[model samples]
Target: MTTYPKQALLLALAAATVAAGLTATAAPAVARPAATAVPRLDWKPCATPGGPAAQECAVLPVPLDYDDPDGRQIHVAVSRVLSDRPAARRGTLAVIPGGPGGSGVQRLAQKGAALQRELAGAYDLVAFDPRGVGASTTARCGLAPEDRYLTSLRSWPGPDGEITDNTARSRRTAEACARNGGPELRSFTTANQVRDLDRLREALGERRLSAWGTSYGAYVAAQYAQKFPRRTDRWVLDSTGDPDPQRVARGWLANMSRGADERFPDFAAWAAHPDRDRDGLRLAARPEEVEPLVVALAARLDREPRPSTTPGVPLTGNGLRQAVQNALYGDTAFPGLARLVTTAQDPAGTPALPPELAQPLRDEDAAVMIGVICNDAAWPHASADAYRSAVRKDRARYPLTAGMPVNVLPCSFWKTAPEDAPTRITDRGPSNILMVQSRRDPATPLFGALEMREALGGRARMVTVEQGGHGLYLGNGNACGDRAVTDFLTTGRRPTEDTHCAN
Candidate 1:
């Protein structure tokens, strides 16, 4: 799983740009001859299944740090699928995967087919794993196996809002990372990712690169555009995030409070519907009753966490809330949460977390989530007390998330400060950017994505999908929103102003 600060910042910025229409030049031309004249990309087999098409994999060398260009170099994993129809081809467009830890290689596997199908071979689709990711110069924080659990890693509070245990745990986790995470762990900053992207563009031999960045990748794409405005072609940012420069990931974490509140209604309405009849999972007769039921159940769990299917792993109230939040990303996962809730409420039935929850996370995934935020910016130290106070307030205001949204994480106890300063995105980028977002996202809330849009200034136009959940484009099935982005990328046409996509 990936953390969402960058996503929120990018999404928020995209929303505002779409609303303002400050940079739009023309309504994209559907029959542009430029799209047809671009060269084809050569595809190669990737180390991973979902990476590039079977024929396009290569290693691009980059500096460990841009300031030390001649220093020890690292390799970034890259892949591409060339445009099959040159008559319809545009330019090369890189796909930026989400997760401060998400794999560009994996994203290509999952979304590549859809993109190829949609754009009519308008551009060669390309992607790469940032350094310290799969096939790249990987990093390991050497976290303890127990600390690797999702619940523990996220820094949930104790049963009764106690901070003593959480603080100690956080410190211990931080210490382990400091001790085990070597140079590679320290190297996982968004700034570094942006630099790596520029290097990738150079290696691809493209003078001006087009890109589609999703979630956290959007921040990277935005940063790259800002850094090299003249080098950018058409750019698309999907499911963006808050661009709160000071807070960065911290702000993204805090926004979860409002995000959960905004999106829970959709879940509640689903859980209460007559369709729940066959599953016997409905929590309430009316949609309004769902909120109270969830809150009360979580409170009960807080007092007495239930024994879970996994040994030594109990389902605490916060854990339940976390599971719910993750489920809200897409409609398919709703049933899993609904099942867990039903089983938890019923005495005879057994509650089981999804396999991803029950099993320990991969070391790489843990390191990504841990290393990125801590490396991106500094977090307060020993912030358990602050977290408790905030969580309590958040619980009252956003019952869907309980108090977990405002809780502390290992970053608070991280042993070191950021190696470099956070990169400030300025309006120094090309005006060839388009953004798409959902109006009510559970992770990257609309308000936060707005801040990012404001920061982008005249560089972008945003398309807001009047929908819910995390990702917006193909992920949300919003035709208008998806078309707006696809059209922009394939033909460089943007809405004159911010536009909305109806459900």
Candidate 2:
């Protein structure tokens, strides 16, 4: 999930900008032709608290709808930390953030120091909040508080793995978005994000842009490369999912089942380790026993819900399951999950709910998450019976996820069809693209990344890190994987072929 403080920072920056009289500009009546000159950005000193003091910020105005450039306009918050050694600067490197909900401005702040040290003054680091995200133009679906919690929004099935509540919630969410999201929410999409990136390129006066895109950002990067091949320079796609145009978001969701299974063993081994005994976190004596212990604990919770630290919000079977899924994203989160599981299993102990489960997401946050996924593609019009059957099958096969991966979501009940067909990624782009992936990412697994590699074909080379986690480069990735990506970005050189990085 996207960090709440980062989201708040973006919103705070937007408010600060408005207070300083930097208002959004109105688009002209006649749509400007693509060949027309793009407006230059007005950069100023705008840094977030505890962020890099050197960071500069600006708001770029782009049409709310690219198809109607003369139509309503919205401001996209952009930030940059220039290369200290300008004499050695190659070009701008855009740090695209993951999440249909991630704030790019915040990502730049988080990774700025590490990137500067790694690249050795090769480029200026830049990033931006997409239309409906962060400090960018905002929109809301005004969803009810109960429906805005992560567990509700994620479509976890009932105690018996039934999806009856899922269908009803899906319909309610879709309706709320359609009723209150307005045009700005409708504008949140992959294609528009690609168009907005081009606008950023034009505004920055760069003929080409190099980028580091991770997870969902990888999908946007791939789309940008495909649409504007010559405009790309040294593209890096980290931990990508399949870019199947037809399946799009649906395919990404379904792939989570495999991802969860692939990542579970790593967590199991950690939880059952001899060292965990000293920490008082051992789940079982053997790695194999950990899975059954968890499964049985969940079943027991389903029968009799345990009270959590939060009032009126008890820990249910699905709550533990959701916590497991989130924890699998990175190894650093393993100990917390182990502790939660241990607490829940104790009859006298109360499990403290994770922040995501304890509180309802901000309405705008929920809007962006649902808006991007649903607007990306058309979901199958599956009936209640279909969802129930799928849930039963998935739960039987992938107990770790508890069938949530394949269950119905708001996309199933989305009122509007996609504005445009999903972009089909191909090898037609420049061969400067390099991909780095983990062998067992809980969110974007190896198999899906391989599919993305296959789709890119001759245009891309991949480095598979023999590690288990969600993100690669600069995060959970091994030293070998990190060095390969750093080498590619700083020197414009790639491995001769797809390579593996031993843990």
Candidate 3:
């Protein structure tokens, strides 16, 4: 799950999704990584153009395969910014990015200054690019350009819930990965990511690390805490997913429909507001009319796709649905999504496709994204008729998603089973985990977050924000929610009980 300041290609929830999800129950016993020497980090000044001015970068060597500790090593790019007040500094805080594709170094650059300001001198901020991400060891499947497009990555079904095309594409994509990805690609699982995190901790010489993991990163952090309970301090899981081992990412995807339904009211209210009339962004005169209006417009688009700014790519019903799904991640996205609908609604007007839809993703970017989720858990190999029936039922039940959530994905035909079984997130860890979630998250819905909370038991205390969005802390949450996270990170004071923060 990816949501942020709405940058191009930062559309993991839409353009590209991730490899795994957290589950509430147990899976087969996990094969822990054998003890290995922590590689040294030779830090040097490496700041991006618009990124943190004082950020330093380093490369950490982690085993390509966790089972063979002395085997091949993959480089994980790491970045760090020391706490300004060394005297008051407590320890290190890792800023874990959301997607299996999200770069932690980039996330640190995006929020480091703000985080540093909020954190004061509590800890040194650190982040990293997991294996196969930016500035790290990478792999690819040499997928066709068409397969890398946001529309294709999401595997959105036909307007009428048809999956024949989706099934064929998913099968072909899986075959390409198996044929070209080689063994290295298969190693890109959530389990390895968690192991890589512990190795990062060892390189830092930190006995216990604090972390703020958002969206998919939250799941990574949770797994880390699960595997190495004694190694975490004041952990915060932001916008977490359900930890059901059987479903994992599939469960996370399926839950998005509920998330969309829960969150759409906020959008409807905004789009129906009288103020929006001034900008010609109003969709309907009333909140109730907004949903129906969107549904009807989508149905109309299904009959005839409209030309878009991008040559050769028309704005279809699924494209509109994707845009809507993406816009739900943040309120700032509302205007653009509204304008898209407005332009498409005009018979003579041409709409502009979002970045993911406008162009195809890079081969490596697409490979890792498809690799992680598909490698995390086993998907149903049920007959095609069964999948079709499920999609039809889903489309009817959750019109906003049009069955995309439950629809087929590249994982449905994936060649590899999870190398390591999924981890069951239990309450066995320290009670330092603080989960802050949106009441209406479009990606990780509140219901899923509740399951995560239940899985963590007393180990986690959640702060539910009275808002609608994917990310919570520092991005979409209100002051109350932000303060909760900041306070937990700095002073280690968690709420006595689960509490709600008013928007």
Candidate 4:
């Protein structure tokens, strides 16, 4: 799967549009009467099991098209666990999730305990599935199971970096989605997701909402803040993407090129360390040698695919490298890659797909990965040519990725033109935004996050952790950065300027 960044420039651009009276969002069109009362909600029991006892679930009705509010309506499944310490409660903080297909209900369950502990009942934790996702009204393209595999879903280029096959697959996938997905699929754009979030805010009757968004979710939170700045209290965007509207998700995928380059050194160092002998997975005697060794291994795999534990499938060098990149995002995944590398080098035995890599991806997972990119923006139909160029150049510059960073995907063949145009983010509303990022993230690079910081103008300050990984805050063990974010969320305080966290 691919990862993207978060940025603030989107807010600035969005604000300019609001001031021009070109369009207005966030605030409801109906003005409030004098002596307005604080909104109250009637909480009911939620549907998900193992959720907090106080958690409530509700189905929120939203327009399939805001301009056509009277048209078809969709149900956005929402959940919330109210503050246990009611007196200490500040306001509500929505945990906007990453994948267009990711279930917010599940996100709340996963992060709920930690968030409740850290924030100390300071805010109600809320989450929701975007329209056309789980528990919400959904759309299906009826894609075949084989086409849903991780490698297939991502549109990895052919053995020689040729994308001719990728082109056909992209076209086929796009056509299937278009033919079967119906109106729901058309409503899956970033703009629609932003609008749905606003509707959720209205339903909750909150004047403002704090948020902690990670990975792709970071962009959604940033977009919401841009569209409704006054409605945002303290916004924390973790693991951001470039705010270049023209590129959007396309740029996010391309960013893997630089991200891989920045993060590979860490792996190389780890693999080359003398201590590696203790683990027996060392590939090189020196850190610098690890890169070339990996590159050569991948080339050898490309020239000769070997039988794997899965009968019909072989672990191509690209597959091995992909597993490596995904594993590098966290320390827990390291052994799987080490095992694969060790097994591959064994002359007496053939390697198998690591258990983590063995199980085929679920359709929902594939849907989210493919849908987000296809829905966010339009990719080049000549994406194959682009991939060819990217892989050839990326392979030379960052061989650890072996041209995979520049590979084509379903977006190239996605039959639908973007159902909606990309939203222009302006610095239109409240300046209550905080962004945190790792210095050396493999998926969303630091340089790209900076572009987002630059875009936010004076509306935001960034906290940079001089660490490595795809996620920050709770994902990494950086107390300094995590504390800074928690402080802002709980107390409305922020650093006077952009700050850095030490290793």
User: Considering every candidate listed, which one attains the maximal TM-score?
Assistant: 3
Could you tell which candidate, 1 or 3, scores higher by lDDT?
A: 3
In candidate 2, how many Å is residue 51 off? 3.0
The Cα error of candidate 3 at residue 254, in Å, is 0.5
List, residue by residue over 1-503, the lDDT tens digit for candidate 2: 12211222111111111111122232123333333358557677766666667888777878887777866667788889999779889999998877777777777877787788888889999999887766788789989888877778778898888888888999988999999999889888989899999999999989999999888888889999999999999999988888899987788878888888999999999999999988899999999998888988888888999999999999988889877877777788889999999999888899998766777767777787789889989999998999889989998999887888889988888899999898788888678999998898777788988889999999999999898886678888888999999999989899999999999
Candidate 4 wrong stretches, greater than 4 Å: 1-54, 309-311, 348-356, 383-387
| Candidate 1 lDDT score relative to the true structure | 0.71
Worst window of 10 by summed lDDT in candidate 4: 8-17
Q: Which ten residues in a row have the lowest lDDT in candidate 2?
A: 9-18
lDDT of 3 at 471: 82
Tell me how many clashing residue pairs each candidate has.
31, 0, 9, 22
lDDT for position 206 in model 1: 83
lDDT (C-alpha, whole model) for all candidates? 0.71, 0.81, 0.82, 0.69
Model 3 Cα lDDT, one tens digit per residue, 1-503: 33532322222362432211110011112232334765777888877666668899887877888778888766778889999888889999998887767777777877888887899978999988776676677779889988877778887788688899989999999999999998878988889998888998999999999999888888999999999999999899999889899998888888888889999999999999999989999988999998888888888888999989999999988889888988998988899889998898888899998876677767777887888888989988878788888889988988998888888888889988788889999999788999999988888889999999999999989999998898888888899999999999989999999999998
Evaluate residue 428 in candidate 1 and report its C-alpha lDDT on the 0 to 100 scale.
Answer: 68
2 against 3, candidate with superior TM-score: 3
The segments of candidate 3 whose C-alpha lies over 4 angstroms from its true place after superposition are 1-35
Ranking by lDDT: 3, 2, 1, 4
> What TM-score would you give candidate 1 relative to the actual structure?
0.88
Per-prediction TM-score, please? Answer: 0.88, 0.93, 0.94, 0.86
Q: Which regions in candidate 1 have their CA more than 4 angstroms from the true location? A: 1-44, 47-55, 382-384
lDDT of 2: 0.81
